[model samples]
Target: MSLTSAPGPGWLLFSFGMGLVSGSKCPHTCLCQTPEVICTGKQLAAYPPDIPLNTRRLYLDNNRITYLPAMNLGLLSDLVYLDCQNNLIREVMDYTFVGVFKLIYLDLSSNNLTLISPYSFSVLSNLVQLNISNNPHLSSLHKYTFANTSSLRYLDLRNTGLQILDHAAFHHLITLKTLYLSGNPWNCNCSLLDFSIYLIVSHLDQPGEGLTGS
Candidate 1:
């Protein structure tokens, strides 16, 4: 299926490494610079299906795109950096990134995301930096939600609707260094006892308030 429909009329195309000799294979709604394809602010309602598979970096920010169904990006095996922030995406189906295993940097902030199943990111064993903040509807979380974040170092969960957190969520994040949990309505209660203890002893650089006791 086509990733997305063309934006029509106005489009932008840039230069590549060896330079364009004759025809250009770039999409009509994006600017391709070889390894990097910038499709920002194109009013896209879905991902451009015609993107090159050899693309390493992709920018799809500031669009109206919604829904990242299963195997949506399965063809981009070489994709490393993906920026899908500031979109209208609601939920990320299972196996959405099935074949895009080389991804290490992902930005899903400023979207309408609500449900993030434990299996949404189960294949990103090499993910290092993840940003899922600014999503007001994303309230709950599960320990298995980060099943493959063993290589994760930076996690951003700021400005979310989180009210509680499980300690086991951080148990396997051995390499984690920075964790942002501010702007959440943390209910510092008995359920967070173990997590509170972890915050007191862990080497993570997490600075926030969690003593609501409500």
Candidate 2:
């Protein structure tokens, strides 16, 4: 007489195989794992390696990345903190961060970025802290670059090489509490008075006494 064995769960095996494949397909240059959640500046020229789905914090500082990858970042819904400071990023494409709904803190400082596209922070509704300081080449910011980012409380623009600030630069930043604008060669002319007044009335910072040309 011959005996037959019981059948196993095919769906579970299929899912496990798929997960392994996904993990294998992740970029080889960077460390990608669900159990370990950390990725620092790895000299990545293209998009970052596929991160584990459960990753909560990411450290991507000091890279040469110029743009965000084409992959859908919305899948990393659990990401609550991110650091992309000190990169060569120049421009942030529209909808670059469409799916990062849980991000509460972000650092984009020390990059080669020149201008922030209008509505750049529109999708970052939960961002409470942001840093864009140390970008010496950044000359201008779009009028609505920070529009709809009501949760942002801290903004740092120290040493950004800023010469002029438009009238509506900080228009909708109602929740801003601490702003740093030192180390810049601010014109301190009539055009900057509007920004100076706004900073004073908002209790962000005090102007340095009289105007330079006065």
Instruction: Identify the candidate with maximal TM-score.
Output: 1
| Model 2: how far residue 11 lies from native, Å | 27
Worst 10 residues of 2 by lDDT: 1-10
TM-score to native of every candidate shown:
0.84, 0.78
Report clash pairs, candidate 1. Answer: none
Work out how many backbone clashes candidate 2 has.
Answer: 0
Model 1 agreement with the true structure over 89-207: per-residue lDDT tens digits: 99875557766789999999999989887767777889999999999889888787886679999999987788888888888889998888888777777887898889789978876
The superposed Cα distance between candidate 1 and the true structure at residue 88, in angstroms, equals 0.8
lDDT by residue (tens digit), candidate 2, 1-214: 0011111255335534544556334555656565344456678665575566566676778778777642434446567787889888887755566557788888889888787777667778888888888888887777677776788888787777777777586877788877777777677678888877776677664233222222
